[model samples]
Target chain A: MRHILSVTVENEPGVLSRVAGLFSGRGFNIESLNVGPTLDTGVSVMTITTEGDEQIIEQIVKQLRKLITVIKVVDLTDLKSVLREMVLLKVNANDANRAEILRTVDIFRCKVVDVSIDELTIEATGNYEKISAIVGLLTRFGIKEISRSGMVAMKRSIQN
Target chain B: MELTGAQILLECLKREGVEVLFGFPGGAVIDIYNELPNTSLKHVLVRHEQAAIHAADGFARASGKVGCCLVTSGPGATNTVTGIATAYMDSIPVVILTGQVPTPLIGNDAFQEVDIVGITRPCTKHNYLVKDVRELAHVIRQAFYLARSGRPGPVLVDLPKDVMQVKTKFVWPDDVKMRSYNPNCKPHSGQIKKVAQLIRDAERPIIYAGGGVITSKAHESLTWLAKNLHIPVTATLMGLGCFPGDDKLWLGMLGMHGTYAANMAINNADLVLAVGARFDDRVTGKVSTFAPMAKLVHIDIDPTSIQKNVSVHVPLVSDCRLALEALKEELAPSLAEYDFEAGHMPWVTKVGVWGKEHPLNYQASETTIKPQSVVEKIHEITKGEAVICTEVGQHQMWTAQFYRFNEPNCFLSSGGLGTMGYGFPAAIGAQFARPDKMVIDIAGDGSIQMNIQEMATSVCNNLGVKIVILNNGYLGMVRQWQELFYKKNYCSTCMDAQPDFVKLAEAYGAAGFRITDPGDLDRVLRQALDTPGTVIVDVRVEREENVYPMVPAGASLTDMLLV
Candidate 1:
């Protein structure tokens, strides 16, 4: 099972390595992770997606709590949440296939952030499914380069 | 008051009540060493950086205080990694101070520079690299706090040369609080009540204690609970001294080289109160079959340790002492009504029979001294009062088996990490920790040489630490495995060419004694023990002797190859 661990840690230069070391040290590989600053002055939140059983997940949460800089850890997978990812791709393009590429980007609600004589850099933002779907469809277009911001997550809010 | 970064570091250590520091001098640490004479701290200069860390670890385990050490950068810093990992694995509180090259030269691969913080990140409980002298005091304070606080372990503070040489206003941070690092102390009352209820209802209850009991000072409570409830008690190797070894309810040390009684009791136990101990593979012996009929109630300070290896039914994440006290309170009323003693009598009696029938033993010979006999003699001569340390090998197992520990912090071994060459230096540290007590390192031929250079440190300090080498001329533990599983393909286990330990000790200006005959064992051991200086009594034991009552790695606890 895949678990999305939303971890809040002290915002320090080495905090990322400290948090990431826990996973690697325990022989657990993080499938996808993204970190960003939070509302608090000296804190940052990290969203890590990893595969493990119930025991391993429990162990991971407990181990995370042991870290000195880690403030909190919550399994976002157990809660109602929204996950998003952004990926940019520089794909081969030409006059013959330019319209097709634009249409494909248009259908997926993506944007062409950059363009050149031989390539188009497409910007994409969506959940895992959407990101993978777009990447799968663009494979035929001969991707020149690719960059992805591994999944970021947030708990859903109920309006008052 | 304004002080150099080095002075500030020493100030923090002094405020933390540190009296002794086991360390070695090097170029990177020259600044710190320069400032040492201005302070009251006593430094025990060790030959190797590794021995310094191990000595500090031994001191901490013996004194129940944080052990501190200082070493230089690069190779000096790298030397302590094994010792750091040893302490990390066993959860011993040690504060390691490593000198680093100047901040500017750290990443430049300057002379004698290495990224120690990055290297030790995974092994340490927490670590810091002081970039500024202003933060030096705070980092030192916090490092000590982390090293000694809940679930104690090694914490490293890397001191850059420039940082140590700089000056800063010494502001001792009284409040060493890290918002993210507070360990849960009070276990849930509901969980304690549940554990209490389970204990009251259990017919065959057993208390499996570990080093946590000693770490949390819960031995008294553990003893009270086990005695009042008529539950049999077993300890992990690290937990040897937590419970009185001679107590009738004591089933002896449990796990791989554990006694027949301890293993069988765990197998049949209906309820296992696992306190302060992790169910390591050595202890669990085929996890699927471990405690097959028992409902495990694990109480540990580190919550992760509770359910990491085995499935825990009632997990109380709290200090062992607090949880044990709470459980006693919760079970107070029920204790009067529950016929616990009568209910547990049958099980305890059965365990006693197992102990009696298949007790830990060896074939005695008048020609060659048996290692087990050597341990028994040490226990007999010392009256089980001395602080016992052992290097990792069959001798370690034999010492754990024969020398029954009746007090906490008396038995020191690299239990979790099983690091060889740990005993001798640890004995040096233990002697420093408790100068009044007789500290002895029961060693094997292969392991005694690892940190054999430390004889200089012990001799220089005039620490009367006795190193009793059980010489069989082989890496006994690995050799035992070869004899058992590998068709006797001895491989590199044979330690044929060995130094004359006694002569070597004499060369270091320490007493040396060699006992080759069984008839001369006691006389030689006594002479060596009575020596006024550091002594090495190398006892030539029966060759090819194996530590038995063995449960092959993957075998169930009950599946023991007993002789």
Candidate 2:
């Protein structure tokens, strides 16, 4: 089963290494990780995705909480949540394939962030599946370069 | 008033009630050593950096306080790694202070520079490298806090030389507030109720305890519960002395090299109440078949320990003492409902049969001494009142099997890391912690020489520690393995050219004794114990002795090689 953990940690040196070291040292496989400064200046939030059974996931969360620099850890696996991943792909787009690429991008609700004489840089932000689909389509045209920001997720607010 | 980082470090240590520190001076810590005499903290200068940490570890285990050590940078910092790992493995609370090259030269590959913090990150519970002088006191406080806090383990504070020399105002914090590292000390009330119900309903229940019981000082609660429930208690190597070895309910130590009765009992048990013990591979043997009949109830403070190697039916994460106390309270209401005596008698009878059928026994020859006889004599002389430390291998097993420990913290050994040369320095530390109690290090010929230089530290300080070396002319445990598994092809297990241990002891200004006959073992041990200072007794035992009831690697606990 796949699980997402939202971890908040103090913005300090070696905090990330401590968090990463716990997972690696214990042989827990980390699927994806996205980390950045949070709204508070002295704190950072990390969204980690991993695959494990209930027992393994529970152990991972508990181990994460054991780090002194870590402030809080929440398993968003069971909660109603929204997840997103962003990918910037540069595809070879000559006259023959430019229209077809734009049509596919429209279908995925993505934007052409940059364009050159023989290349088009497409930017897509959505759930992993959608981003992956766009990348798959762009692969038909030669993908010159690619970069992805790993999954970032949060609990869906119950405003409705 | 302003103070240098070195001054602040001393002030903070004194505030924490630290009277003694074990360390070796080096270039990186010159400033701290310069300021050492200004403070009242007495430092025991160790010959090797590794012994410094081991001594501190032994002190911590004996005193139930965080042990502290200081070492210089580069090789000095690296030497403490094994000791730190040993402490981490056993969950001993130790604070290691390592000197680092100046902050400006940290990554410049300057002389005597190593990233101590980076090196110890995985082994330590927490570690710090103070780049600023203002953070010195706070980091020191945090180091102690983390070292002694929940599920205690070693923590390192790497102090760069420049930071030590910088001046800053020292402000000691009244409290340490770590929001994330709060360990759940109290077990949930509902979980306690469930566990109590299981205990009431269990017909073939066994209490499998470990070092956590000693760490939490939960012997009274554990004893109360075991006595009330009429349950048999089995312990791991580290868990020895947590329960009275003389008690009728005791099944002796369990796992690899454990007694036949303990392994058989755990294998046959239907309900295993595992307290403060992880299911280590050595204890479990073949994990798939270990306690296959039992529905386990694991109570541990560290969440990661539960369901780590084996899945538990009920996992209660809390301090062992707290959990046991809560379970006792919960068991009170239902105590009258269950007829424990009638229900548990049959199981107890079966376990007793197993114990009687395969008791731990060894024949003592009239001409040549056996290692077990030496330990048995030591036990008789000390009456299980002395603090006993052991190095790894066959001697350690003999000590664990033969020594009857009735109190917590009485048995200190490298149970987790199984580090050799751990016993002597550890005994020195234990003596320091318990000045009135007799402390002894039961060592092997192969193990004692690893840190034999510590005899100087012991003699200089008048620690009065006794070292009993079982001189078997071989790395006995590895030799046993070679004899059993490798067709008697002993490779590097032979130590034919060892030193004259008695003379070596005398050279360090300590008394020494040698015994070759079984009859002389008791008298020599008594004489050594009566001596005013440290004494080393070299007992030449049977060269081919082996620890029996052996569970072959990857074999089921039930399949034991009993000779």
Candidate 3:
């Protein structure tokens, strides 16, 4: 199972590398990782997605909590949350295939972000499964290239 | 006042109230070595890098403060890796600093250059690579904060050579910027009551204490809780000193080589209250069969440790000190009715009978001083005030068996890592941490030589450590195993020519004593203890002596074959 760990750490030089070093050195395979500054000036939030057995995940979280720079670590797999992923796919498209691609795009609710003589770039945002399915349907027209921002998640606000 | 990075390091150390540092000097760390002459801080120069770190670990374990070690990069830093990992596993506070090949040559893979920060990240609580000269003071301060705070583990700082040379204005931070390192020490009152109620109703209650009790300084509270609740106390290897061995209520250690009665008691107990102990596999064999009749109550400062090993019925996430105190208070009012009963008296009597039957008897000869005799004599002379450190193998087990540790932190051994050559350096570290107390390393010939280089450190720093070496001509422990399982195929366990440790000590500018006769055991120990600096007692013992009452690894705890 994939477990998402949300960690807050002090923003300082080499902090990111230290965190990455910990995972790699300990032989923990990180599936996906995203880190950026939060509202706080000196604190940064890192959302790391790791696939491991329950015990391994628990060990990883426990060890991560021991890091001095880390402020808080929350395993969000058990919480009610919203998870999102973004994927940009450029597919072969001309008048011949454009109508079929547009129909497929409309079904997946994807917006065409760019267009060229031989290709069209469709931007889609949703859960990973949804993006993968849309990309699978558009592959018939020949996928020119693809870029994906891995899963990012947070606990949905109670009011929402 | 102008300050160098070395001086800034000293001031940072002073703020953390560190009085001693164990290390060795090399070309890269010469700046710190030069600055050492001008400071009040005492630096112990171990012969090997590994011993320095072990000694630092011993200091931390003995003093409940962050222990510090300094070394140069590359081999010096690499050597301490095992020691650092050992401290990390046992949760002892240690801060290690390695001088690097100047910043310019770091990435060039210059001579004596090693990525100490990257190497030690997993084994350390945290680590810093000092790139900017201005960050030295802050990094040093941070090292201490990370080491001694929260769960308490080793932290390392790799200082580039150029950074040490660059002159920097220094100011120690009153508090570091670790927003996430807060360790929860406060006991939840609700959980305390639940534990107390469970203890109150337990027909057969046992309290299993581990090293955390010693680390948290919760001996008094633990004893109070055990006594107030009329609970039997069993210690893990690390927990040996938490409860007085001579105390009637103490059930001795629990696990593989643990007493039969202690294991039986834990096996039959209705409730097992574990304080600061992780149920290591060595302690709990055949997990499905272990303590089958008991419901576990685990109280640890680290929340993850509570249910990591054994399934716990009640988990209290708090420091041992606070939880124990709270448990004592809650159980104090109604505890009298549950005081020691006739059933446990049989166990006490049975052990007493076993002692009388076995008598810890070892034959004394005219030509050699028996290791057992030396241990007994030390115990008689020290009156249990001295702390004993032991290296791994036969001597470690023998020390654990023979020496009665009546106080917590009185026994320091590499129980988790089982590292050889750990004794002398650890004793040096323990002695420096507690200058007023007597510290001795009960080491075997094979184990002592692994880190015997530490004699230099003891002598140079005037650590006042006493090393009582049980010098058998062979690796006695391995020989015993070979004798038992390998048809006496000794292979290479035998030593051809042993260095005269007496001369070795003298070479290091320290005192030396020789114990050829068993009659001189007491006198030799007393003399060594009275000496101002380090002393090595090379005791010739029977080469075939073995530590017994060991249940072979695959066998049940009850399947011990006594030799």
Candidate 4:
């Protein structure tokens, strides 16, 4: 099972290592992690995507709460939330498949951020499935370089 | 008042009621040493940084206060890692202060530089690297608070040389607010009621207590709950002194090296109420088959300690004293009418029968002194009053078996980490903590030599700690394992070429006594105990004698290899 944990912690030095150390020390799997400051300068939030069963996740949450710097841990696995991941991929392109590449990018609603004579850099943002699809189709043109921002998630408000 | 970081550290320590600290001087800590004259704090200059941390640990365990230690960087800080991990494993409250390189030189691999905070992150409950002088006072206060709160563990504060040299206005934070570190100390009323109901319904109930009872000082409540409700009690290696050992309700120690009665009782128990004790692997031989018939209710201060090793039906996260007190109160009214004692008579009788059938025992050897008898003689001499510390190996297990502690904070052994070379220096700390009481370190020949140099520290301070070495000329515990399972290969378990401990003791200006005959055991132990300064009594015992009633690693508690 996959769990997206939203962890709020004190914004201070060594907080990242503490969180990372807990996972590595305890042998818990951490698929992806995103950390940034929050509205309060003294606090930060970390979105961690991890894989574990019900028991391991419970242990992970309890262990994270044990950290003195960690403020709160919310498991957004079951909660309705918005999750996003971005990827910057430069693909090999030439006159022969350039039209074909533009058609695929148009269908996926992605943009060509950079284009050279023999290469085209595509920028795309989506959930796991959508991003995987666009990246998979573009890989046919030979991926020259790639960068990814790991998953960032936020809970949705009850606007309805 | 304007104060240097070094001055503020000492000031906060005194305000926190610290009377003594163990340390060694070094280049990184020169600034603090220079400011030491300004404060009236008592410091014990130790030979090695390891002894400083272990001695501090001994002080904390004996006095139930947070132990403090200071050391220099690099090798000095590294030396304290094993000691810190030992304390961390047993959940002892120890605040360790280490001096680091200057701020600018932290990661540059400067002279005597190391990332101690990074190295100790996994072992420490919490740690701080003071980068600014203004944060020094508050960080010191927080280190003490974190070390002593919740589950209680070792906390390190790394002080850079620049920070210690800088000056700032010191304001003692009266209220230390840590939003992420608040521990839940109250159990839900409904859970207490449920626990009470279980106790009432259980016919063959047992209380499995551990080090938490000692840490939380919940012995009184634990004893009352056991006696008033007619339940048998068993303690872990760390929980030996938490309850009266002679009490009929006591089922002796539990787990791998635990007594036969305790293992059997837990094996057949109907409901096991574990208070302030984690289900350590040693206590539970095979986790899947542990307490085969019991419904477990675990109450511990740390939430993560619950269900970490064993599953429990009822879990309460609160201080051991608070939870036990609540349970006692919850059952108070019902106890006034119902005969709880009468209901558990049969179960207690059954446990008593098991104890008689397969007791913790050994055959009397007239010529060669038995290690178990040596502990028994010590128990007789002390009358269950001396603070007993033991080094790891056979002597440790023997002490745990024979030295029945009647009070809390008396049995200080490295239970969780099982670190060797722990007991002697710890005994030094214990002696300093309780100057009036007789402190004994029941050590092995191999183990005593590990920190035997601390004899100098003991002699210099005139600490009357008796180090009783049960000499068998080999690492008896590992050798026993080789004889039983490894085809008697023995490997490197031999230590026959060690120094003559009596001569070694006299070499350090301490009294020494050696007993080769079994007849002289009592007289020599008594003589050594009577000596004014530190006395090392080395008694030769049977080399091949092994501890029994062990539930071989994966075996269930009921399937013990009893003699």
Q: What is the TM-score of chain A alone in each candidate?
A: 0.95, 0.95, 0.91, 0.96
Give the best candidate by lDDT.
1
Specify the poorest-scoring 10-residue window by lDDT in model 3 chain B: B351-360
Compose the digit string of candidate 1's lDDT tens values, residues B291-407.
999999999999889779998899898999999999888877877788778888898899999999999889999899999999999999999999999999999999999998999
Off by over 4 Å in 4: none
| Residue lDDT tens for model 4, B315-408 | 9888999999999999989888879878888999999998999888999988899999999999999998999999999999989988889999
- Lowest summed lDDT over 10 consecutive residues: which window, candidate 2 chain B? B175-184
Task: Report the candidate with higher DockQ, 1 versus 2.
Answer: 1
| Quality class of the docking in candidate 2, CAPRI style | medium
Task: Give the clashing pairs for model 1.
Answer: none
Give the range where candidate 4 chain B is weakest over 10 consecutive residues by summed lDDT: B554-563
Give the B-chain TM-score of model 2.
0.99
Backbone Cα, N, C clashes tallied per candidate: 0, 0, 1, 0
Displacement of residue B79 (Cα, Å) in model 1 is: 0.6
The TM-score between candidate 4 and the true structure equals: 0.99
- CAPRI classification of candidate 4: high
DockQ of each: 0.90, 0.68, 0.46, 0.85
lDDT of 3 by residue, B23-110 (tens): 8888889988888888888777778899889989999888888899999989999999999988988888999989899888888988
TM-scores for every candidate against the unseen true structure: 0.98, 0.97, 0.88, 0.99
lDDT of 2 by residue, B1-563 (tens): 99998999999999988878999999999999999999899899888999999999999999999999999999999999999999999999999999999999989999988888888999998899999999888888888988887799999999999898989788998988776677788898888888988898889999999999999999999999898889999999989988889999999898888899999999999999999999999999999999999989999999889988899999999999999999888886666887787899999999999999998878768888989988988999998899999999999998988897889999999988999989888888888899999999999999999999999999888779999999999999999999999999999999988999889989999998999988888877799889989899999999998898899988999999885
